[model samples]
Target: MAREITGFSNPLVKRVRSLREKKLRKREGLFLAEGLRILTEARELGVLPEMIFLASGADPHPLASALINAVEAAGGDVIFTTPDILGKMSGKDNAQTLIGVYRDRLTPLPALDRARAPIWFVAQAMRDPGNLGTLMRIGDAVGAGGVILVDDCVDPFSVEAVRASMGAIFTQTIAHASWDEFLAWLRAGPGQLIGTSLNTDQDYQAPAYVPPAFLLIGNEARGLPAGYEAACDLLVKIPMLGRADSLNASVAGAVMAYEVLNQLRRTGDQGTAPQAPE
Candidate 1:
């Protein structure tokens, strides 16, 4: 049975609202996933939240009911609250009918499967949560082995980023490491580290990316850090046809990541490449 929460001062409600701040999220080691789709995805991925919130008076669809049952079976709590409270929890004018408080799932570098033709997407100092989320979605789309965050990147668990990921957050393996630590890992032989840069003469599509390719992307404004290109096994660039100097960080990462998939497909190398679009 779902418990009713009527007051805005409820501790669970306040904790869910506090997740909007990075500090609180980090301190509590929890994050929120809003909407039926995201929570369903989480359940499908076997990631049951610590608790779930349902808007009072909201229609109880079969799927929603199933989720509630599943949460109860898993020894998790489900709270039914007023629409206003749900809205406040979600930080939206029109709150979702369902929201989940999931534990942080970020893993250490050792948790990544380095033996498989491990194709990874590495982002350095990424500032945009939306872009990071989009890259996570793209990484999942292309069958990337995992995503590695280098240095001080935006919180991948942020509400904006998680929403942008469209549920990839639950499915994808995420890791964090410093630049040097990342370099050490690369040298340990997970695969080639491919960097993207405007200064490079090589077209992104030209290379036949070997298995275990790490597609390294830079910050939105700074691009790759200075002197870092030399560390990459290969440096490639996306050609610009229009007057635009560069592509968005996520856009650029998507283009290169797909190209890696394309090259793997052309070579008939399974190498963890996603199925070619039909």
Candidate 2:
């Protein structure tokens, strides 16, 4: 049986509650995972939890049951507490039913050349968690390499972002890097570098895509940084027919990803040479 943990005053509860702050999350190299889908993805990604936190009424939630079974099977620890205590620990109104302590992937940046096989979505200073999550899902959909959270973006592992991702987070390789490091990699990396902007004279569909490209998507409100505009080998813009001006960050990212993937597939299809029979 999972150990029943009572009281919000417990030291473990206090520790879990502290995870709401980014500093604490970074310091501990851990993050919170709420809901069944997120937990399931974490497990499938081979992310063994350090510990599992479940509310008293959590057994009824399908995700909660799955999480308990998964955790127990992995020989991990599960602690049962009250909903009120869970709410206090999670720092969110909707976080009561299910939660977990997961070790952040924090996988070091691999050889950027190795990563070049897949397309990449780089979002700079993106603020909305939902937008970031949606972009991750899109990257997974198009079989892109992964989504890179460059510079001042929201915590990709946040409860909101994880929930918004709909479990797509597990299938994607998410790396956070500084602007200098990211730029350095881009300059030396194997993939073609592409940036998106409203001022670009080039249409999004005008040029044929050459993979392994990094399609840079900027913040919804501010767009790309000043330096990012000049960093790309080419900058392209989506044609906007309406007065609204711009698409959401997620929507823009999805369109660009699909277009690039389409072009790459076409190129691959054409490159396969016919074999002559003896």
Which candidate number would show the highest lDDT if scored against the true structure?
1
TM-score for each model: 0.95, 0.86
Residue-wise C-alpha lDDT for candidate 1, range 97-171, written one tens digit per residue: 689999998888866776554468899999999999999899888888668999899999999999999999987
- Model 1 scores worst on lDDT over the 10 consecutive residues at 269-278
Model 1 alpha-carbon drift over 4 Å, by segment: 116-118, 273-278
Q: Tens digit of lDDT per residue, candidate 2, span 1-278?
A: 37988876788898887777778988998887776567777777777577888776523576567768878898888888877787787676745656778877544455433343457888899999999888888877777767777888998877677767777777667887988888776666566678888777799999877767788888889888878788788899898998977899999999998897677666563221122112
What lDDT does model 1 reach? 0.86
Candidate-wise lDDT, in order: 0.86, 0.76
Model 1 per-residue lDDT at 42:
84
TM-score of 1: 0.95
The per-residue C-alpha lDDT of model 2 at residue 118 equals 53
